[model samples]
Target: MKDHLSALVQKANLGDREALEQVLLKIKDLVYNLSLKMLLFPEDAKDATQEILIKVVTHLSTFNHKSQFKTWVYRIATNYLLNHKGKRSKEFAMPFKDYTDLIDLGHSNEVRYTKNEGELSLLEEEVKVSCTQGLLLCLNEIDRMVYILTDILGFNGVEGSEILGISSENYRQKLSRSRAKVRSFLNNKCGLVNPENPCRCTKKIDFLIDQKIVNPKDLRFAHFSDRSIDLVGRIDDLEKSVAIYRSTPNFPAPEELLEEIKTTLKIN
Candidate 1:
């Protein structure tokens, strides 16, 4: 697939409209999923994915074969996300201290029951996704990225360092610290990770719905597809706390975004 994408990249750099669109189709989901993980909101992720794809399209010629084309795309996407000052970025910016405090205070402690078991299961999935993604907001952008790439995505230190343009040693150090931080919180607080933990996704659904943090009518992350992080990557190899995140649904980029980009670039 990489070789095929490389062939398309060559054609795209030479201004082949069809090849360019094909290239966009290939990378859109990857960029969108990364943006979604980082931004935590579907709308914000869509906007970020659009910008990242545009960057990939406009900057196609600048991609020398020094790295894999996918790596180049990752570089551009990560650069934009790390520096992005979008609304969610500002809203979620806070220290771990404040974040943990919010988690402790946010729960209603009473589990809400739905008549249908399926409905209850869906709400539980919603809370699971929302809370875990929200936990990422506590880390600084760099740590968050490192944790996502190395821990959740199962990238090795060398590959992670290459993607982030940091030394492997530095990458390892950051991964260790970030992993420990996220893992510690999950171990102590998330019931999915530790059954003994007081916090349960089932118990939080009613409170989340009442507060409008989650809507049963419109779930953002649950039921997207059976395609999960574990299916895409090696989740079992990771620590249990981090492995819980692998159950998250991997969202696809909106198909219309590709057509809009083509229109903007006048590719057709």
Candidate 2:
């Protein structure tokens, strides 16, 4: 597949539309699924998907093929979303800061850092899940991009460092401290503030708040109970999780829209 992508990219760069179309068909789902996970909103996902298509079309000539095709495609999608700056631009976004401090990194920097490579890796996952709950509320746009690209997307520290234009060691250092901050926040929010203390909200909010990325409905003072938890979980576990995930209408794949975009861009 890698070799095929390399060939396709070379062909596309030389102005082969058929090769580009074949590559697009091969990667369409990978691109869509990634956007779905990151943006956490269907509209945003679709918009990002469309924007990625345009970018892939325009930038196809610039692909160096040093990374995998999948990686290059994902880079396009990430850049599209991160570039949308300003007021409520993220309103349509799954903006992490807008969520209640689900992960709590309070005032403490007591996060454990060891020289042991094995130990750093072993603790990384647990720390990531726990910290995201609290510190997501505090992370701004660029920070969220770096964290998501490295942690959630499974990009290597070095790869992530290059993408964010930082040294690998520096990225690793920041990642460790950021996770600590998030864990601290989550711990505090879940009412584990004091090792001897209890939660402020009931058991319900405690459970919901511990999730790495919770919905906006629960964050805005809307209470969810045990039954609601079960309901939400069951719905997710359903065989049709993708089919009924949202209550909103799907945007039409209108020809006029495509024609408008194509005519404006002068891409036959």
TM-score of each: 0.92, 0.53
Off by over 4 Å in 1: 106-113, 225-236
Which candidate tops TM-score? 1
Residue lDDT tens for model 2, 22-50: 77666665555455444544455556666
lDDT of 1 by residue, 1-268 (tens): 8889999999998978889889998999989988888888888888899999999988899999878999899999999999985686567667878867766765655565475887877787777788888888788889889988877777889988999999999999888888889888988887767778888777778878887778899898877845342232355566667777776757888878888888887878
lDDT of 2: 0.49
Question: After best superposition, candidate 1 residue 177: deviation in angstroms?
Answer: 1.3
Q: Please, what is the whole-model Cα lDDT of each candidate in the order they appear?
A: 0.82, 0.49
Candidate 1 at residue 257, lDDT?
89
In TM-score terms, candidate 2 sits at 0.53
Error of 2 at 84 (Å): 1.7
TM-score of the candidate numbered 1?
0.92
Regions more than 4 Å wrong, model 2:
33-38, 85-89, 92-138, 188-268
